[model samples]
Target chain A: MREIQVEYFAALREHAGCGRERLRTAARTPRELFAELSRRHGFPELGPLKVAVNDEFGDWEAPLADGDSVVFIPPVAGG
Target chain B: MKPFAFSAEPLQPASLRRSLADPRCGAFVSFEGWVRNHNDGREVRALEYEAYEQLGLKEGARIVQEAIERFGVDHAACVHRVGALALGDLAVWVGVSSAHRDAAFAACRYIIDEVKHRVPIWKKEHYADGDSGWVNCERCASHAQPPPARQAGR
Candidate 1:
């Protein structure tokens, strides 16, 4: 099991009902971790997204380590 | 000053413009993204912008650097606002300076476009009807539209 810190933004934050959380999980990748959290939080179907590990853009399949921070980036809209 | 940054307070474009002053550069171009009052047929009352600052700043700085390298511009800077913003507020500003007009114009455009598509910033618009939605995530299907064509007789 790995302990990870997950942060939410925009719609994910609204749906997840919190901005940040830390928990222990058996999931090893961001994709798997997101799936577990989605079930727990009822996160909406966000369509296409990106994941960040340790404050850098990360691949969905990247391995997660204990005490790592992750953020799922929804489709961005800025001008 | 850094090439890209986020501001919680209102943006000051004039000062940003002055920052790009250079004796070698003869042209300056800028773009300002304002908080408009409507979107996808909804009357927007206000907007709240949120960003993953760590990634946003990193990506944003890379974009500015890319603009400088790609277009050969002398200097460039961009600032995006966070938190609540009312209608007509300056949401973002980009300034570029170059030895000529062409590079300045192209770099300015590149910075703004890439910033919109690449930066990890999100906008949640509050509508006049007491409804709100994230700009691209919640209502993207309806918001997508064809490229604008030039009007007759400009």
Candidate 2:
């Protein structure tokens, strides 16, 4: 299993009940990983979300790497 | 000082204005986004802002640079607050200096608009009734006006 760091923000944080965690997963891509975690955590499938790998915005289909940091950005609301 | 930045401490608008001082510029424009007391009929008691700082800073600076180039502004800067904030707190600030009023005004608007749309900052509003919600997420889920990424190519 590849290890990854996942950070939650805003609503996702509340749903996941934490800001961050390290997990061992077999998911091959960010999209699959998020789907697995959302099912496990009961997170709603919300869209318009952006995925970031290693702090840089990236595609959802990007392959997962061990120790990669992933951030799923929800619809931002800063003014 | 970098043209764009974020501060967890209280923002000082006077200090920001001072840094943007340029004798050659004839117009100065600014915008301040204050935490309001209410949102969509709920009484908001406070708000907490969180950001992906590493990415937020890079995107913020890029927006500022775009403002300077697209509007022909002499200089531009923006400051956003993080952490807990009470009602009426200065949540965000943007300032632009240009040789003319038009560019300064246009650039200031551009910076604030882009910062809101592009930066990965989240705002959670704590309500007086003890409930809270992430701004845009709950509301946008059903009524999203198309994600920015999809509209970016236009």
Clashing pairs in 1: none
In the range B7-105, model 1's lDDT, one tens digit per residue, is 999999989999999999999999999999999988999999998999899999999999999999999999999999999999999999999999999
**lDDT value, residue A79 of candidate 1:** 75
What proportion of true contacts does candidate 1 retain? 0.44
Candidate 1: segments with Cα more than 4 A from true spot: B139-154
Give per-model TM-scores: 0.93, 0.90
Model 1: per-residue Cα lDDT at residue A16: 81
The list of candidate 2 runs beyond 4 A from truth reads B139-154
What interface RMSD do all candidates show, one decimal each?
A: 11.2, 4.8
Q: Using lDDT as the measure, which candidate wins?
A: 1
DockQ of 1: 0.25
Supply the TM-score of chain A against the true chain A for every candidate structure.
Answer: 0.96, 0.95
> Candidate 1, residues A12-34: lDDT per residue as tens digits?
89878999999999999887788
Error of 2 at B70 (Å): 0.9
Query: What are the root-mean-square deviations of the candidates from the true structure over C-alphas?
Result: 7.5, 3.4
